[model samples]
Target: MTTDMKQVYAYPDALTEVEMRYCPGCTHGTAHRLVAEVIDELGIKDRTVTLATVGCSVYAYEYFDTDAVQCSHGRAPAVATGIKRVQPDTIVFAYQGDGDLASIGMAEIVHAAARGENFTVIFLNNAVYGMTQGQMAPTTLLGQKTTTSPRGRTAPEAGFPIRVCELLDTLDGPAFLAREALSTPPHVRNAKRAIKRAFETQVAGLGFSLVELLSTCPTWWGMTPLEAIKHVDEQMTKCYPIAVFRDRLAAQEGEQSAESAPGEGE
Candidate 1:
């Protein structure tokens, strides 16, 4: 907060905006910073191509100063796939929400992973769909109330929340799959690392990469900023575990080392 104080780090130049449009206490701002930081760290802001999806956070392109294209609801991954395929040298990524990924964009993501596209995906799972009002999303936990389900999501009708990392890890294409949160100090640090790893994987020419982030929705959840962070750690962590579901890059490195001659390990 002082000029004499050396800044350990700062936001990406690509994200030069006046605060954000997200609700106070919402995790989208943190998530945006994480993505922007990665772009800045890797020096890929110019080459990066971000796909913004429909949702409360659809205006992400306005904040991210890189080349970004807006996509329809639940179609970010599909659009990103084409973009990366055409411009293999470009760093392509998709920013999606629970409603965009777990619910409507499920098929697109599954296929993209199966095909092993070289791109990154940032999935923000906030339980409820915050865009078109608070609706119970596919990632919504059982007994979690939303505008669509005032009585809470019943298992009989809503089924269980979809764990995107766990599901995508089961595929052969996904080179990196991790789930992290921005609820706590430690969690935020871990989340930033995971996001960086995701981008690094793509840069390494590894297949599909996805980082599922557990975020806070203060407005939709009807909680204050401080209370929302606590809820993310307590309630959200239960549904989405914090861990790397898969890492094909490590596996490949191991395999290459094993195949190399003796004393050639890098």
Candidate 2:
């Protein structure tokens, strides 16, 4: 008689054995794992460098096994650009939150994308300033209540939420732009695929690539983990639809296929 074998999931080698500090129901941990999994899958852990931005993602360096740089609020893109320029062979990425990227770092990201900086940007948009006590963020939905907008964000007062993917799509320099949610199992799988594509864009020497992850902050949102997950699907997706805004590789391939069509020579 032979014994049956069982296979189980294991921690990614790209992630360190350090304990995570995120609060209960926070999806930052899941985002981190996804990034780490992508790095492991791509076999780039040795050459990968992560730029950890301020706010909720400030402690990312302690978790990722690769080289990490701690950037000031909204400065991760600028820092990442420098790192990639100096060491072109290394795989560089900046992990930033909505409060850090869409708020204080907006100019940096736009300029970097405009210049076609070759790097990956993982933007975590949880709709609130998680580390700063749930203040209104640039990506916060209209009518959403936050510490700064307790009465609910109004169109006239707060203006509409900034759709980062849509805004970046208008720029001509970025190689890829997409948004993914981390709410359910299917959403999580899609988020991982987007993250992998972002990394692949950089690996192929493409220009700027960004994958915005719609995440959850249960503690700040004052909801249970399940409720927060539901909120991401029901509320956040309304303002920020999950889809690819730009894909240079796919466009190039389509052009090539068209040019080589059998009837083209006729």
Candidate 3:
């Protein structure tokens, strides 16, 4: 037995031991790990509740070790809202895919954010409905082809892809809003950080918070695992720039700092 090797990483306790069934190379598992890691890091595993929505992640309730609920398509925000209100101290977060979130549940999410619901949302944007045979989703990049849009998404026919973080940033309710890609190691680390920030906002009793993760669906994209991740790193990011659109926590901290600064000649 070699005693020199040391383990730097271990499977997140918040994540279950169930075998992942996502398509090889898909980033749903990566996103799941990031969320689970945040749950673990926040020491909220006992109080965490995950609302799993329809789409590829419909069975996500089985993957997470925390208390989870199976929500109707596009209704995760509504369910999460109810949970957070009933048990304000619990850490609640919704896991949703692009179609489940940016499409059918659009109204639910918008209103929840507008009301400043004290919860978090972990949104995965793969640009297509990977579970339902790769239909064009609300976040699908223009000119990207899907089973429903075999000719590529056209501006006239499909309109432009929805940038969720940017849209939510326009609202005053959210305490945090950001987007990150899961294409490479560095980007994955950043995605985890963004997720943690969203969780932190909820822990601080701030308003709505969401982290949109640009994910990969290799099977639907007609690419190998490596190719799918590359596509996200290159093409998909062009349509949705990775950045923090809003962070009320950071803003409030900045304001506090300025207020405490010595005035004039101290």
Candidate 4:
């Protein structure tokens, strides 16, 4: 079917019972809604096991209705590995922030991608570390000022933002990989597709799948929600291009078809 033909519905059963505590203009709420919608759409709510990593998203467990687990700073991937290994049929997913994924839990993420473990990862890259008082995160853009980088992020001292999609694409184990954003309506549509695609990959018994979402932190960034989305479109997309990196599972199917093609004589 064409991409335009796909329809998305509201997830009634997956709605959060508690009010959100995120700052105004924060895209976490949008990201959470997309994930919950994906879970409901895929019909994996009961069978799903979610891992909420430390950082601004620590309260993810409280929002998502599925069986959720809270892990230490940046340990969601490791926890997901254990859960999926023990319960192979369960749909396992890890929701983590850039600080948790690219900084403290870098080792875990790299190894998980390298091992091609069967799980889905929803990585939220909000530039600065929102939960820890606006510190510079691994995905903070150049010249972006944070509480830690008061004079803007200097290349000589802070280094460049790690492009998670490009970093993980170099690894051989991931069956599917993509980068997305939750800024605008079109972006939200793409983000939903990317997220669902990741889960669908795991459900098919393929290897690891990850969709890194370039999100917004209005409170930390000192902007309104609308401004934050505008900023992400203007600044963030330049650093992290939204696109698919790998589709090994799909490629393998194509290869099999090519090999089984009829001979010219037949």
Where model 1 places Cα greater than 4 Å from the true spot, the runs are 1-4, 255-266
Q: Write the per-residue lDDT of candidate 3 for residues 62-155, one digit (tens) a residue.
A: 9999899999999989998889889999999999999999999999999999899999999999999988899999998888999999999999
Ranking by lDDT: 3, 2, 4, 1
Clashes of each: 1, 0, 0, 1
Residue-level lDDT of model 1, residues 111-194, one tens digit each, is 998888999999998998897888899998889899988999998887888998888877888889999999989999999999
**What's the TM-score of each model vs. the native?**
0.94, 0.93, 0.95, 0.91
- Evaluated at residue 120, the lDDT of candidate 3 is 94
Pick the lDDT winner. Answer: 3
TM-score of 1: 0.94
lDDT of each: 0.89, 0.91, 0.92, 0.90
For residues 64-146, what per-residue lDDT tens digits would candidate 2 score against the true structure?
99999999999988998899889988999999999899889999999999888999999999999989899988888888899
Judging by TM-score against the true structure, name the best candidate: 3
2 or 4: which has the higher lDDT? 2
Error of 3 at 166 (Å): 1.1
